[model samples]
Target: MNELAAQIGVEVEPDYRADESDPAQSRYVFSYTVTVHNRSTREIQLLSRYWKITQGNGKVQEVRGNGVVGKQPAIAAGHSFRYTSRAVLASPVGVMQGSYGCTDLASQEAFEVTIEPFRLATPNQVH
Candidate 1:
């Protein structure tokens, strides 16, 4: 695909670490590893990120940051950037969705690439 096509791919692996989670106190800690792949034909630099995190209790949190894990990675054409991040929630089950702010190196145009919504649930918390 082309830059104007703006096709970026994302993969997320979310895990619930019971050792670090205190479900009894409503504090759940989850870590997710994201693999961002550049499916388009142009190189792109990740500028920023915006995340919409929702707790099972219905509370929503907006996280705006400069980059993923302190680095704004540049994904060359047909390449990928992978990073791991963590999140804390007030409930056992929650959902996170957002996008990455990126710029096309060839045209200097900016775009938002979607990070598909993923679930964060402690084991046995959801059936």
Candidate 2:
């Protein structure tokens, strides 16, 4: 990872939405809140997103899109942007990982901030 990528931090908190999930029908709904922190001295804008989702049943899904939650947010130095998003899986357990495409506002330099793999599981699903 480049210096710009190293300066950005990504954190995710995932929850299983039992109300929206139907286990009998093999549908599992999960909501994850992500916070992107800009640790660099320069302002940065999130340009796009890339995600990889893997299910316990050995299924994988890849998603790529512009911005997140419908907006390309510009986060100032030492600031953070947070958003909540949803994902659906056929299995009760899964993992989600991705990267954010960002650009430094001052220099227009582009980089990717890694989003480490995080668990997505129903209550007591993973031990």
Candidate 3:
């Protein structure tokens, strides 16, 4: 779809910590920064988003919401927008993949911009 030709880039950072109040439950948090470029000739509005998160134990969670962090961004042709968000999982490893629902302002046509999969790892991954 020409209307959905925009490019998306995602960067992820992982943070792990043991809960002081409950040592049995460790907290694994992953922060993601997303940049979306409007490569099409028309301006577009990001209306919604869909996310699929997979944990270390093969459990997958799907998240769908209206706008990111409560704000809908409109990008004109040749422009881009960036957002940062965090996801918390119970395991030290996981991956996230999804898409952004976008609409062309001129024609009001809807399309989806795909988000590439990114990894979340612990400190051990550095070795």
Candidate 4:
């Protein structure tokens, strides 16, 4: 875990592989597993998510939506939730970063939880 990961109380682990469907296109598919923990005493409701996805060609896409996977997770103190998502990039190298909008159930006030940027690369780009 790193500092950014610690700030969000979440850990992002990425697993990427070459896209067999289009080997010559340089496209790669990546899946990230996010584990978020509620460290506060109050229950937190994840209301929305914002993501910035960049392709190898320098094109960027921003996605904002209500919750993930069509479900809002209410996490209690010391509890955690996890979700898996996929992304496709034009090149084997790119990154994804985002934040989660969460509200304290007790206060009804919302705050953004940062989701650290994670890399997507092929075996040759590992170094």
Candidate 5:
């Protein structure tokens, strides 16, 4: 419910796991669940994903992949696809933003669904 673009809806929820993190080594683990909703009239298939991760120290990592969680799901109009993924950062706080490439099933037209920036922070960090 955070952002919607190109007739697609993107929601990102992040959770910080203290049990899996080691602050002394500067390793922070966060799990994020993403939901991609098809808001358009045309049916769409999620083809790929593109992400840009920024660490607290200004480090950036670009990730491009064929599909999410090893699946290319075809979402019907008004339906949605949801998946969870994990990220490891060298800092207590960071950011992630990206887009999903989708194809219109009927017309075979390709378009990008924008995902707004979301924060990855430990429980103690202030917003």
Candidate 6:
């Protein structure tokens, strides 16, 4: 990974939305909060996002789009940007991982910040 990419940290907190899910209908809803840490010296703007979602039933879904939640945010150096999003899976358990395409505000250079795999599961669904 590039130094800028390494310095750009991505952390995720996922929760299963039991109230919004319908297991009998094969609808499992999950909400995830993502925090993007700008540890680099220059301010960066999130340009795009890519997601890989894998369900317990062995189905995979890939999503690619510009910005997150309809906003391309510019995060100052040493600052962080946080956003919450929802994902609906066909099963009670799943995993998600992806990366962000960002650009250095000063240099206009682009890089990718990786998001580590995180689990989305209902209570007691995974031990």
TM-score each candidate: 0.93, 0.98, 0.82, 0.86, 0.93, 0.97
**lDDT (Cα, tens digit) per residue for candidate 2, span 1-127:** 8898898999999999999999999999999999999988899999999999999999999999999999999999999999999999999999999899999999998999999999999999743
lDDT of 5 by residue, 1-127 (tens): 2222367889999999889999999999999999988887778898899999999989999999997999999998899889999999999999999988878888887778888999999987875
Model 2 bad stretches (over 4 Å)? none
In model 3, residue pairs whose N, Cα or C atoms come closer than 3 Å (at least 3 residues apart or on different chains), thus clashing, are none
Q: Report the lDDT tens digits of candidate 4 across residue range 5-53.
A: 2334878888885444254876678888889988776788999999999
Candidate 2 vs. true structure, TM-score = 0.98
TM-score (C-alpha) between model 1 and the true structure: 0.93
Error of 1 at 11 (Å): 0.9
Instruction: Compute the lDDT of residue 51 as modeled in candidate 4.
Output: 93
Local accuracy of candidate 6 as per-residue lDDT tens digits, 11-124: 899998889999999999999999999988889999999999999999999999999999999999999999999999999999999999999889899999889999999998
Best by lDDT: 2
- Lowest-lDDT window of 10 residues in candidate 5? 1-10
**Which regions of candidate 6 deviate over 4 angstroms?**
none
RMSD values for the candidates in order, in angstroms, are: 1.9, 0.7, 3.1, 3.7, 3.0, 0.8
Q: For model 3, state the Cα shift of residue 4 in Å.
A: 3.3
Ranking by lDDT: 2, 6, 5, 1, 4, 3
Q: Give the poorly placed runs of model 1, Cα more than 4 Å off.
A: 1-5
lDDT of each: 0.88, 0.95, 0.75, 0.79, 0.89, 0.94
State model 3's lDDT: 0.75
Stretches > 4 Å off in candidate 4: 1-8, 19-21
Model 1 lDDT at residue 120: 96
Candidate 2 local distance difference test against the native: 0.95
Write one digit per residue (lDDT tens) for candidate 3, span 3-91. 25444333444444434222246567667677777766788899999999998878899999999989998999878788878888777
Across 1-127, the per-residue lDDT of candidate 1 in tens digits comes to 2344357888999999788988789889999999998887789999899999999999999999998899988899899999888999999999999988888888888888888899999888743
lDDT for model 1 comes to 0.88
Clashing pairs in 1: none
